[model samples]
Target chain A: MTLKRLLSERRAAILEKWRDRVFACYPPETASFLKREADRFSNPVAHRLTEGLKGIYATLLGEAPAAEVTAQLDEVLRIWAVQDFTPSQALAFVFFLKPIIREELAGELKADAGLTAELLDLESRLDGVALLGFDVYMRRREKLSDLKVSEMKARISGLLRRVGVDPSTL
Target chain B: MSLPKPEELARVNYQPPARGWMEVKPDFRPGTYCNAASPKWLEWIDYPYPRQWSVAEEDWQLPENWKEIVLEGMEDRLARFRSLKLFFDICVRCGACADKCHFFLGTGDPKNMPVLRAELLRSVYKRYFTRIGKALGELVGARDLDEKVIKEWFFYLYQCTICRRCSLFCPYGIDMAEMTLLGREMLASIGINIDWAMASVAQCYDKGSHIGATPQAFKDMIDFLAEENERITGIKTPVSYNRKGAEILFVTPSGDYFADPGTFTLMGYLLLFTYLDLDWTFSTYAAEGGNFGWFVSHEMGKRLNAKIYHEAERLKVKWILGGECGHMWRVCNQYMPTWFGQVPSFLEVPVSPVTGTVFENARVHKMVHISEFTADLLRHNKLKLDPQRNAHIKLTFHDSCNTSRGMGIFEEPRYIIQHVLPEGHFFEMPPNTIREKTFCCGSSSGINANENMELRMQGGFPRANAVRYVHERYGVNHLGCICALDRATLPTLLQYWVPEVEVTGITELVGNALVFEGEIERTTDLRDRDLVGVGEQEGGEEEE
Candidate 1:
């Protein structure tokens, strides 16, 4: 089976385990909340994240086009951005898919004739996902910094306007 | 070694190699700590100290006999507040409060730990006040009150927002918040005061509000808010300024009169009062509800808070209706009774005119938090509210430290929000991070100044950290709090850490949902900005 077919076959189990590992970064109680509760608002962090990660999984597995997946990719990455995860910790989740795919299709890949090439292709694809995740993380960081500047400017913007510096200049 | 960068201090749980605090001196990095008071503000306040100095200096230029001044101040506080002596004397060195502080939890700095920060003062108290500490010295965990000790106290105490979250966790009921105040009072005695707080207190005393909003300036700002209300709701709500014979005196932090989000909350107050047709007046004399003096010292708190009752008497109002604020209510609830032995005859046992519900709890203080008043009105179904007006916004209420812990004002705000906004739009940050366990806005007390933005960001991390959870997971966009300080600083902090979320005072939401009887169809929101629906129509103003 191709890597795409393999991902589809074990999609539910793979996504669940990957999400469990992600939630495991929190303390046991917090991890439980991240896993057990499913309210969109009450358990918002966990609820949005599970969906975002699942969409990224499907997009990388070629279920959807790249253009269609940027928002989902951004949503998942935005979650990691605000989280306590460092750059490596955040980006590592993308690479996590590589291992999960490898283990899930281990028996089939070994039996198939051209499977070594397929495995290499899959590894390179995971590497691409990791790179994309890294870009998203950096963009999120830059957004936060930009927000700092604008908020400071906005703080005095009103007073400045009252003082008669052209509003456009601010 | 080198000083840690702000981000490194926040991310790393790694402690610098230290044998112990006694061997190590406090380090004051630029951008992470406050500069000392300017000579002008000190002279203005008649505080005896150097006119100009910097925390960056090796010599703070404290008054001569500074050590004597500090010791005498300590002794006086110890005698006056038994709570201070109890906080100073009793500590089993329990680690419960160590990790509870938002600063310590956010920054991972050991001295930011409430126990250790208090020990900076406790260590000194051990030397001079406790017989065992003086006799045993280093063995008893006591250290001398030297210049290094003073710098250490100044750095760490001011870093504390005095949220009192740590006090709740203390098994022995020791309060690091009170200890921080005690440390500040002692330091101020010797002229080692931060400029933001001292300057605000002085400004508040002299000009009727922090930032020197004089009576005319106060009137101008109110006029501006009134105009914004007129433009948004399309209803002419004429604001009364310092008018005598009004039934209620309205007091709020001057931030409302000047700042955006706070000003929006001010617009909420005007609309609510006008909607109910309540007789009220905003006094220029007691223009500010927030007490910078309370953050500074006990004496200053008393002096600053005396204005409310004095203004109430001057206006001859029935009772004071406090606007949305945090420490404003904290001082009013916890300290007002002690400040005034009994309610002045001018102020009545605050009966909410809109609901006819008497605030028995606040009768002794003659003050009512607007949330309490609003919640009671909602309970009685007094006002016509359109909760659907806020459907586009997702909301969360940050239980402000002072309001929730200091004054036990949690449910009233939640009650108010549930009345005006959809429950599905609201999300909890984390259970542990909400209600009594709520984290601070990271810049309350007097540390809301800008010089320590980096430090505030680090201290604010845990709250932001929790907020990020809800924001990413729930698509949550709005954060509401009762405190004006929270309203002012949380937006700035959120802009830095969780850029996706916006902060507002709860009343801003309340005003948005209020349906004024026979008013022109609402076209703009309280910020005087056009809203989603109204912008689709011919936008700017009604038929004159």
Candidate 2:
């Protein structure tokens, strides 16, 4: 079978496992809220997570272009980056897919020797996506720092400006 | 845009650390917190903390006996209130409330937890008051009440909005709000309170209102509203001030007298009273229902809260009808009678004469939430409404933290809105984020100061996040809440997070829907903007 056909056939089972592992990163209460509520508006935390994973899933299936995959990585990492995760822990979910993918496609690899070569390439591709996630995480941190500086100056800036003491000058 | 979008990352990541929370010192970064309290109000309130300290400065100037003052303040309060003493002992730190605080949830700072916000003070309470804490010291989670501890208290305590949502879930039923109130009281004892909170308390104490709007200023405001009402309804709404014979004394948050959207809410009160031909008078002496005193200290809260009862007695009004306000109702419903009770017998149970609905829940307090009163009138079909007037606006109700959690006023405001807005216009934010479980406006409790915009946005994230969801789904153009501060600050909060969504008070919707008899065609809404092609007419955009 073709690589796309293999990923497509087992898509539901693999995605479910990947989603559970990602949702498990959140506390039980938060995870339950995200899991129980499916509406995009009410359950935005879940929607962001799922949409982010969908981009990754589509990329793995060769359905999404590289740019689309990067945008999805940006969207997904934005939420995870700002959360209570360290640099390593934040993007660990991306790398987590390697083991899950290897396990889910184990039968395919054993059945066809050619599939083993495709799995090797797919593993490296996952690592590259992990690198992309790291870039997004660092960029998010810089944005936060810039926001903090701008916010600090702007806090007393209104009063300072009103009183003829230009905060910018200070 | 504004409320923490997971976009404003904190420079100091408390996600993984080697040290315990108490061991970590709080550094006041420029963007994360508000500037220190202004010296002028601190001096006027006779607060004992340093007069000219700055948060950005390296050293916070402290008095020689600041520790003694704080210790004495805590000792005095512990003796004065049983709840304070009980709270100091009751906490086992099981961490039930660890994730409950919005600040902690948004910022990932453990100290912002209700468990730890109280623990910051409780750790000291143990060192000084408890036997094991003094004996065991840091091993027992007890730390000396040092300058670093004081700075940490200033940082984390300000992050708490005292919304009491955490209190609802605590297994011990320990009120973190009560603990923080005492913590802030002790802080204020040393003049360590934020200037934004003290500013309103000083104004409310010296002037009749928290905003310092004098009687003449209030009259001028009422005159403008009356003229605006005349333009809309072609009937002049009579606003009586300090009228001795008036049967009802209507006092609202001073925000209503001065601020936008809140002013529209104030207009709703006036238009409804005029429509019913109700006899009510506004008292400049008790013009402010907002008790900033509640935010800082309990005694100061009483001094400010006493005005409603004192004015009701002096004016000989049968009862008082409070306007839509947030912490105001928390104090009125839960704290008023306890603070200034055995309220004079002259005040009767507030029964709406038009609807004949006796507001039993508010009987002893002798004050009714304006939404309760309006909803009662609306339910009984007493007021003539043209909800179609507001048909152009699509909105959602954001249950204010206090009223939903503190008072269970969930259905009243929603019932009123359902009647006032065009059908299907109102949408509920996620169940976890609304009614009793509502997220705060992020700017409540004195944290509303301009300096703490970063923290405020983070704190407001859950609310704004939920709002962004609804804004995406329902194309919700307005967020209607009952609290007046929600009116004043949410516009800024929404502007930052969901710029398309605007904030409005429940009564503002009521005012727009009010079809006054003998009224001229209103070409514009209360905002004085052209309304001909706006709102329910086509699907609504921003009202302006």
Which one wins on DockQ? 2
> Against the true structure, whose lDDT is highest?
1
Q: Cα-based RMSD of the predictions, in order? A: 6.8, 7.0
Docking class of 2: incorrect
Model 1 has an lDDT value of 0.78
lDDT of 1 by residue, B1-544 (tens): 8885332332342213435767767657655787788778778767777467888878888777888889898888889889989987778886778767777655445677788888888888889998999899989898887888988888898989999988888999898888898889888888888888888988998898887878987887678668768867788878897899999999999877777678788888888888888899988889989999988888889888898998889889999899999899889888977887765777799998877788999868888999999999999989788877777678888999988888788899888888888668877777778888888888888986667766777677678867877888899898999888887789878876677898889888889999987777775667655655766565344542
Per-residue alpha-carbon lDDT of model 2 for B156-194, expressed as tens digits?
Answer: 888888887788778888888877788888877776767
- When only the first chain is scored, the TM-scores of the models are 0.88, 0.87
How much is the lDDT of residue B45 in candidate 1? Answer: 69
Model 2: runs farther than 4 Å from truth? Answer: A1-170, B1-15, B528-544
Clashes of 1: 4
Which regions of candidate 1 are displaced past 4 Å?
A: A1-169, B1-15, B528-544
